[model samples]
Target: MSAQSTATERRRIAISALARELDGSNPASSAARLSEMLDTPRQMIVSADIDGLVSAAMLASVAPSWNVVGLVASSSKWLLHPSVSNEPPAGLVAVDLFSLNHDSISNHVVKYGAKRPMLLNLRAEWQAWDAAVAVAAQKRLFAVPSIWAGTQGCYDDAAKADSSKWKYPLGTAQILLALLEAADRPPKFFDRHYLPWLVANCDGGVSTYTKYAANARVWWAVMAGAVGPASLTEQVFRLVDGMRPHDFLDTVNALDRERQASGLDPWLNDDWNLANSQATTIERCLRWLADLTGWRDPLLGGIDSFAGWVEKPVKASGAVYIGGANVTTKSTEAAAVASLQGARSALNANFYHGGFSGSRFNWIGGW
Candidate 1:
């Protein structure tokens, strides 16, 4: 077989192997399997994008012994958020990351309240410091990195390096000084100082890290746009529009294998971020594959067919705004019926029961 054919065969076999690992039967075993895949602590913390976030919640659910704290937008508004509902599906606690004042966070850290705190997005610098201080105060609280910071290669060096062992003491010191001189530390400092150390220490250097981060940005944008502002979402889709199909598929396939092994569902679910992320990725991969083979997605047609194929579905797939809901059924037909009934039940129960709802339904054959 040719090189291309051999690669394709390898990917197919890999995907099948991964699907078994992701069978969703035992989450603890799946998490253990996932832990083996990460070479660095940063990967554990930074890589939890959409599917990663879902897998974290799953592992927390199955392993109740490990305390999982979810950092949300607010301490006061969290109860109002749908996350207060049963969607996390287990003993995961959602807390306002900002709730603990400086004193409270310090006190909480000393107590080591949460075992592993999961920060899905670190939009600003202070958030990173907040996570670091919380985790550093207690070694048991795993130091998790941000999706952008971890995957981007900026934080990987510090994350992977043993602070006790100093290879380039001078360089490290300079970076530290730069970090302290907030104004002098340009955004590029991360790209310049830390990326070199990461490349020198890790397997893949800046180029490899760049490719991964770019792909992750695309996946994140899709999930974020599902509940976030449209303008921000549109900008992210445009960011990776020019990425080669082969490269994009390679990343998706790699992630799919890992996600499945982690016991993340591949189907699209309205409530599950991991499932929705997988579904959207699958759609994007299929669209790219079609274009590479000179086949147009009949659903999308335009002058720049490839661009049309890429942009339309990404925007449309996540456009249907819906709140989080936990759903399970034996098949797609059952899912459809259950979802419809659940919506109606929720509405009626809310109207009659004063904004509170409960559901217990039976399917055909008592499934």
Candidate 2:
């Protein structure tokens, strides 16, 4: 099928799943359901383009009705705007902070307390944080907590005690969100400092790591576009060539040995043993460096080639005549080619085929 057709089919599948979820159907009904629903795996769907769906008027929320036994009603229109290409989506709600400021609940109970009102308020803030997360998820936006705000259990010990005493980090989610909202257009580029800061601070899981890495690349590409290729070349070189080749190779070999001793396939257990994300990223940086410098570096080229081999299958099929030299023999190469093609087709049918290099070609070597 053509790329456009494939994308259209994917969009249809995604929207249909959203519709079913709105209809109060569970997403775990079957394998097809899992494939269609964005939220099934939770992790993968969390960072999907939820804003696009909302803009398309495809999302709705079900709220409990006033009558206890009555069915829930759909209320609250959900809409989202992508502030930055790299930042998570934010929700907008117009509340009268002025009214709350003079209210009995805010003045008597919240502001001035005879007992530990701060703790109570903090608890309420925590609840609000949870609600915000839910809203963000419903909109299919990234739900990143403030680094210093203590949401999702990410905060310093002292800051967690009192909401009023919340401390802010430089690269906190709030800052990023604000930047995203302030920008007139999607932020495709970011400073080098921001990239490392994000990587070092981001929480790790497959989705979190993937998003962070993707954003970093986006920033790199943007910077390269603005300043010219020379600066990007330096940055890419620093990232890839800074590491010692011996150290990386030794680490991979050691891991392989350990996996062999444990009777486990290193490729399955530890992706780095194969052409994993780390290896792929490193190779990509090297290739970008080569392109920038216009010089063929052996180390970078070698690693790039090795990574490709690891990512792609090595297929060798040729017939050998078993009859004596005096007798003529015929071998069928067409059968071998057909068999290989069939296997390739089967692999393409599976999700996430062709390994990291194939899927992430831009990052790997093609630039």
What's each prediction's TM-score?
0.21, 0.18
Clashes of 2: 0
For model 1, residues 204-246, the per-residue Cα lDDT tens digits are: 2123325544222322333223223433223223333444545
TM-score of model number 1: 0.21
Clashes of each: 1, 0
Q: Write the per-residue lDDT of candidate 2 for residues 1-367, one digit (tens) a residue.
A: 2323333333333334322322213443221221233222111001111111111111111111100000000111111121211221222111100011110000000121111212343334334434533443444322121211122222212322321112111112212222222221112223342232222222221222234332233222332233233433224323432444354344446645755786743232232311222434334433432343232332312433433322222122212111123111124334423332332211011111123232100000000
For residue 170, what is the lDDT in candidate 2?
Answer: 15
Q: Name the lDDT value of residue 209 in candidate 1.
A: 25
In candidate 1, stretches whose alpha carbon ends up further than 4 angstroms from where it belongs are 1-49, 61-136, 145-367
Tell me how far the alpha carbon of residue 350 in candidate 1 is from the true structure, in angstroms, after superposition. Answer: 36
Q: Residue 338: error of model 2 in Å?
A: 64
